[model samples]
Target: VFIGLGVPLYQGYGLTETSPVVSVNTVEHNIPSSIGRPLQGVEVKIGESDELLVKGDSVMMGYWQDDEATRRVINDDGWLHTGDKARIEDGFIFITGRLKDIIVMANGEKVAPVDMEHAILEETLFEQVLVVGEARPHLAALAVLNQKEWEKFAADNNFQDAEKHSEQVEQAILERISDALHEFPGYAQIYQLGIVDEPWTVENDLLTSTLKMRRNKIQDTYQDLIESLYKK
Candidate 1:
């Protein structure tokens, strides 16, 4: 839309602790789908667990009178942990997911569900998806189906119960998910799935004000369903 309107738009990345501005794309060196390069005096690097770390003059000294909290984020070396998973390719930083949001499997494999969820959502059959597998054997997902797309899929597949769960429907959904995540590592594949009829929204407290998933709350609400997946 911006391109059609002849308006140049760029995406940037930053945090409040870094005085709000960290990296931005300039007119001369703009790259799509990247947070651009770090500012002149702002140093950025990928720390442990792929977390983005920052250090420079723009970084804050410490939290207001909260030494412990400040120390937890900013190390003795003055590298402030940004709490975001990212990668730098050709000087452009691309955020993958949040470090705190990473799902560590029982086998010690760390999976970033954000990228997987985005991949599954591209199928258009799913309206929302949350990948969950913390300390379990494998990965599983809870998803809300797109009603219009589900109706069409059910009709085409000759499914009798369109709105509810069935072995056949579950298999079909899993197949779609598998296809969506084909490029990902084998361990990152979701082994089981739970379908939900309701959509998550800020009003229901399943989503934050910025429309981000409230993972803990959603898991709590669907604890039984998630547990059943593991049992099976």
Candidate 2:
């Protein structure tokens, strides 16, 4: 839509620690999905667990008056850990998720809930979704339904009750989720789900000022529902 309106919008990737500019797409070489190639004199490489690492003159020396904190991010070789999981293809960068948000299952399998949540949210019936399976057997999700979409779906299906957690509703949602995650690995599939009508927002304390999910707080607030998913 931006391009149709003659607006040349570009996407870029960076962090304050790296002087705030890492990669950017230009009009001459733009890949809508990628964050573009690293800037001149900037070196980027994937470190352990697919974390994006940077080493350049723009990289900060260290955190102010926080040697221990600085040491934790920047290695002896001067590579600053970006804390974002990413992949580089043909010199373009694609951010996948945050390393700090990875969920580790009981069997030691690591799953990035951000990617899974994004996939599930594409169904339109769901307004918000949080995938959780930390130290559990399989992945599960707590989702908030889009009321308009849910009502339409319920009417079309000839359901007398539009109960959020009804067996029929759960089965329908699971099927949609399966289709959305078909490209993902078997381990990434959601085995159980919990439905909620309320949406998480900054006013509700479930989201941060930056609009990022407060995962711990959300989990704690829905502890009973989450535990029931596991119990099933």
Candidate 3:
């Protein structure tokens, strides 16, 4: 086993139009959360829409024989529209979430689901939190627990009653979600949460074949569960 000691290796990002690497994370100084700094020959900038744009030699000359496609991404100034949303802090870039998946509330406050997902996963027991409340006023989440931990807790308590076990599970999930994210701002807090019996999977069409989440599919399938959780 390669027992390497580090939080991050390097931040690397690329655009197809750019034939070469745009941004690469530094191996020596690893930034845990950020994607790392831009590469030597790359120039990175963020537009008002928060989309990360790159202008560099690494950029592709243009779309392959597709003038229309080339024009949309690469402007006359030779910047590639990366179509990625990123946050720059302390001279480092961090990909918060996808621009398409970004959620903007009624009050105009923006929330990236991955940012809150990271917050929820701070606790080891926090298996997953599908940050919902898209187009709504505030944020909410559908949290799933580590089933093995939940089962072990139930067994340790010697609680054979099904009703009591269910109650304990709900209480435990809620308490952990609340305490796990105490450091977050109020709007970012999980206003409410619900639990799921099964984990997300591709077999049920809730995830991609590679195991990445298919957010829209999951949201549609669990619409009622999510709605009920937010109703309270």
Candidate 4:
């Protein structure tokens, strides 16, 4: 199944000032779809804007070289203002989206693409997907398959060729994606998926060395293919 090396555990929050991780998930009182409670030494509170604010022993003394930056985040109450927007419900924390990733649909729906994209990935048809067209009525995705494994499968099946195997890869992914998407709402579902024959790699500048995609670059590189997926 799709899983992470760690507990993916939920817990404490952190700031750049707090050395990045201050809280983590706890098993005793875990909540689904929630990043568990705060760490023992950290203090958390909802700010006027409902943004999370934290103060703790782990909190840095101040910005090392940027004094003005330091004063701006730490208030008279000594709370370090974290720019991340989140909310607490039933004593659990839910981060709607990053400040940058949040999108308001034309119908007033706040869509978090990662939420739906993760659902698509859960099917294993794709190694990665980028849900795009924010603020539009419908959702779309750029999906890249796990081609190496498909290539190996092709040999086992006696396809004897990369081209034949590639075709199978596309068909297999399309069918799997269709089945996996049954749980999504119509608007949230991926109406079309742009398929890329080429894989993403840092050498080609499609991704970072760590493999995080440069979404805008990939979209531009495959613009024609992407729009074609939406064609009737």
The best candidate by TM-score is 1
Please report, in order, the local distance difference test score of every candidate based on alpha carbons: 0.93, 0.92, 0.74, 0.69
* Model 3, runs deviating above 4 Å: 1-11, 26-36, 61-72, 88-92, 152-172
Clashing pairs in 2: none
Per-prediction TM-score to the true structure, in the order listed: 0.95, 0.93, 0.77, 0.61
- What CA RMSD would candidate 2 show? 1.7
Worst 10 contiguous positions by lDDT, candidate 4: 1-10
Residue pairs with backbone atoms closer than 3 Å in model 3 (clashes): 10-25, 11-25, 11-35, 17-60, 18-59, 18-60
The predictions' CA RMSDs to the true structure, in order, are 1.3, 1.7, 3.7, 6.0
Candidate 1 vs 2: which has more lDDT: 1
Q: Over the stretch 38-120, how does candidate 2's per-residue lDDT look in tens digits?
A: 99989999999999999999999999999999999999999999999999999999998889899999889999999999988
TM-score of candidate 3 versus the correct structure, residues matched by position: 0.77
For model 1, the run of ten residues with the poorest summed lDDT = 159-168
Q: Candidate 1: misplaced stretches above 4 Å?
A: none
CA lDDT, candidate 3, residue 141: 74
For residues 1-232, write the lDDT of model 4, one tens digit per residue. 1235554444455667877775566768866567777777887778855567888888888887988988988887789887666787766777655544555567876666666777778864477788777656666677766667556656665654455425454555556666777876666666665666677889889998888778778878887876766563
Sequence-dependent TM-score of model 2: 0.93
